[model samples]
Target: MDNYLLLKIAHSLPGLLLLLGLLAHIFMLWKANRGGDAAVLQRKLRRTRLISLPLLGVLALSLPVSGWVLVNLVGWPLGQTWLLASSVLFLAVLVLGLLLAGRLAAWQALAGSPAPASLLRFTAAYAGLIVVLLLAIMGLMGAKPA
Candidate 1:
């Protein structure tokens, strides 16, 4: 098999996993928004976290590794406009993802206590950031010049 085929497969499988995890999270949020019980939503969130943890770890590692392989081994240009824009937006999404994750943890911890009226803010933030990250994912896949 060609190395390019292998590389493409490697690039895609993890993306599918990440997309699955994101869909699961969105489902949980939808349920929560429908006034689902706190304990139920929290459990749903935990399940999503468990499903995503390994996939996300793989994503974090593959990014730099694949970028190096593409630009160095395969001699793909790092100076392309698409690559530059994608890189910038990807970094922004990554930072926001980290922040949203921390907030999710805090909200999950709060699940053990009383449900607060203020968790709506966290929910809104998480959803918004996730949408941005999802858009970043689409951008990475599309690789269109900006």
Candidate 2:
């Protein structure tokens, strides 16, 4: 197989993995929250964070590196609007993601204590923004405008 194809696969698989891992984490959190057991919630959140966070970090790092390699291989200039937009969006996602992870870790530290309503609200909003930004990044990548 061609090196470009391999790089494309490496880049694309991580996108799917990242999305699936996030959705799974969210679902687990929702389920844990619904159970109304603080201990269970904390445990679930910690487990999800421990398992998914590293995978996410790996995926996040690999996606850009593989993409950069593919862009070079294809001879697409880095200055192209789509590429630039995607780069900026990727940075936003990375920052927001890290913040969200930190928030989750903080929540885990609370153990059986109730979370502050403000923190919960902030987390929801932050997650929503990350989702929207991710979708936008996907769109920019697919459109690849001139």
Candidate 3:
């Protein structure tokens, strides 16, 4: 009904979707790789590169814009501790996301052959950190003083 409600929904929906998308990609890619069929894993990686990754990128990029608008809508000072903390965490998430993207590209490049375990490990660590940071940001957002 109101601008705040609409904006809040806009802000929240993408965050949830981004989380789910990351989890799904992790699971799907893991499954594909574990199946021990290089073609399946290659196809999965290519699909992720072509489709899911860009969608997730768009979702990730939309968050800060919506969050800024929502914060302004609520008239909350940007300097508040929780806001500051979440902002910092969001930056970390973005950085990790970029690193993860690079790793994914490397993985895709190696998809023709047997992928090395280290690349998967790094990607998993990055994704896991991103998930944890996102959850922390959600917690901070949910607990902000009214």
RMSD (Cα, Å) for all candidates, in order, is: 3.2, 1.6, 1.0
Every candidate's lDDT: 0.65, 0.83, 0.92
Clashes of 2: 0
* Candidate 1 lDDT: 0.65
Which digits, one per residue and each the tens of the lDDT, describe model 1 over residues 66-139?
65565565666788776777677667756766766666667677765655666657656765776667567666
Clashes of each: 0, 0, 0
Best by lDDT: 3
Q: Is candidate 1 or candidate 2 better by lDDT?
A: 2
Q: Which of candidates 1 and 3 reaches a greater lDDT?
A: 3
Q: Cα lDDT of model 3 overall?
A: 0.92
Residue 116's lDDT in candidate 1: 66
Arrange candidates, best lDDT first.
3, 2, 1
Candidate 1 Cα deviation (angstroms), residue 120: 2.8
Pairwise TM-score winner, candidates 1 and 2: 2
Best first by TM-score, ranked: 3, 2, 1
TM-score of 3: 0.96
lDDT of 2 by residue, 1-146 (tens): 99988887888888878877777777788788878998889888877788878878898889888899999989988999889989999899899998998888878888888888877777777677877887888788778743
Candidate 2 wrongly placed segments (more than 4 Å): none
